[model samples]
Target: MLLDLLKLHLCEACSMTELHEAVALGDYDLVAEILRTGRCDPNHKDVDWHDRTPLHWAAAKGRSELVKLLVDHGAQHCLRSDVGWTPAHFAAESGRLGVLRTLHSLHAAMDAADLFGDTPKRLAEIYGHQDCSRFLETAEVESRSYRRTAAMKGIPLDQRDEDWEVKKEELERNPPYSRENHTSSAQKKKGKKRGKQ
Candidate 1:
């Protein structure tokens, strides 16, 4: 495995090493040790694959405890992957109701959309995750009042306005499950567009 990882020329953030595997495996003790010893970043992303933080894997895998631990340390629920799939999106798609509940309580953006412009609720419905879809629907109805005034409000707690562009670049640099060259070209095009504007 080490040789394979070395041959892949993957960055530390890539899903080529111990940290990413341990998280995916839901090895709680290993995850805790890795984070506690500062051997791995709690927010490390597999830019090459899932374009997700460890928390996303945990949430999607229905490892609620791991998800909580990851969040308690540091994980941004609002951050989008290459395809704009957030951890919330994955949880909903997988029918991980408990994970969805945890994310909702954490104030994960209930209305955030993916690259296809499908929100988690929309995906849940499309995928026949009835219970998860219902949860999102209920939350939407309950939060309607807040949603009305939220557009005019300042940045919510999880997202940083100043960090968006940097985040975008980072996302492009390590797109979810994309070849490096492919993302590099995309990044260049985006960079050029930014320059033009």
Candidate 2:
């Protein structure tokens, strides 16, 4: 009851143009309406204000719905602020573990470091958010493992790695390099025997 009343009260005082405010205040209705109507660019950074994007605010405040909505509307998940801090940095400092997970799922930069050389996970540990810290540590390890394997396989580190492998197998079934060779040694041997017979 109090939260709804607060939202109503906050929305009343906010300008329709301030998408950042809407995200910070957890006003999903306003955000959805704006995105649906194309009233604003979801990826736009606030130049005159804090220089952060709507996704940044949503992540900082632990607003999962807003973060998901912003990303769905084509927000740049890995965009950095003036201080080189990304949305992940904000989420970690505040112990927003679920927000961190959501950002990672959206392919946000988990390894981005701020001007002080502190990554989101490092900041989480420094700020005493143990769960967020541990989560990021695990995520980092998994990401490194995946990247190393992808490198060894000589494939791009993209979400389409599995699809790439399948496509490669399909291509290898009729490899162009072997196609120009005319025939294999087995075929040559069979031709010689047939000719002799």
Candidate 3:
């Protein structure tokens, strides 16, 4: 029974990436060690958690230090989850002002909107994070200014997640549930009911 239990534990452990686990557990030392050894990709998304990366977890957990570590290790802060929620979104939702500040300092896209067209600032407002919302009000303007300056200077910014964009495009093209689809299905149901009557 002990051997079986050990095997089960090992399998469960193997299912979650060490980097994600370390970040989630808030084990700074273990996370640092894992990054140093390059044991896992910092940007690896957790499929079981709506495609959230370690950075997302760190931001949500209000771990500004971990956010820095992940970004330094080449984590893309622009990466979005299944719903297009970036690390900034998570931080804003959880009122992690420090994480937002950390992300802004690193030139993350704080003004990025999710699939629902809600930016981090909007999320902060929605979640009643007045402090975060106030900060983001200025941050969003600065973010846009920085982008424009970079464009004028011909400085390339690594802010876009091309893979996510492509996936988003695919979802838009073949959405499982859209307004038109829902309306058509509703009409079909009504027609069936009328025929029965």
Candidate 4:
């Protein structure tokens, strides 16, 4: 396995990490082997892919076993991408109900919102993933409940990404214009043109 990995590394000029490649390819055995080696950080973000971790890939691919393996190996469930999307968001978008269930069972953050204030539930709704949306509706409530309980019990929760918080705060301080604003302005111009005609 090591020889195969070494040969792949020597041959491929891709910048993505071996772990990322394995997860992206949905190679369960290869992923397990990589995790066992303990040489790679499971939480290492692929900058080329908008700072997405291996866990995000597993969730997006709906690999329940891979998701379990990654989390068990100390992958941070709260890690977000460049756009502040958690693994839950990807799973919801792709209608990965089993992946969502697996993540919830593992105590991963299910109610986290992205930079655009879209929760996993919202993404499920937008993507017409009824099953995922329904599951997320209850999961969101349960997630909040346990999070509050953990806080009161003084149990540390790995639900917040500190770096993302800083970036979020910065964005809030100097917020950019929303796409809605652009669309509204275009609509108003069209209305005025129609009235003139």
Which candidate has the highest lDDT of all? 3
Worst 10 residues of 1 by lDDT: 180-189
- lDDT ranking of the models: 3, 4, 2, 1
lDDT of 2 by residue, 1-197 (tens): 67655654554353333677778789999989878766566655665544577888898899988998988887777566654667888898788999999987766657766544678888787667899999999877766676677679996532332333454466567555655555533235346767998
In candidate 3, where is summed lDDT lowest over 10 consecutive residues?
180-189
Q: If candidate 2 were superposed on the true structure by all CA atoms, what would the RMSD be? A: 21.3
Which regions of candidate 1 are displaced past 4 Å?
A: 1-17, 141-156, 160-197
Please give each candidate's TM-score.
0.69, 0.65, 0.82, 0.82
Across 90-193, the per-residue lDDT of candidate 1 in tens digits comes to 88778899988887777666777654467778867766789999998986564454555665685356633233447666766866655533433223434677
Question: Candidate 2: misplaced stretches above 4 Å?
Answer: 1-17, 145-197
Angstrom error at residue 97, model 3 = 0.4
Model 1, TM vs. native: 0.69
Q: Rate the local accuracy (lDDT) of all candidates.
A: 0.69, 0.71, 0.85, 0.84
**RMSD to the hidden true structure, all candidates:** 10.8, 21.3, 9.5, 7.3
| Error in Å for residue 160 of model 2 | 18
lDDT of 3: 0.85
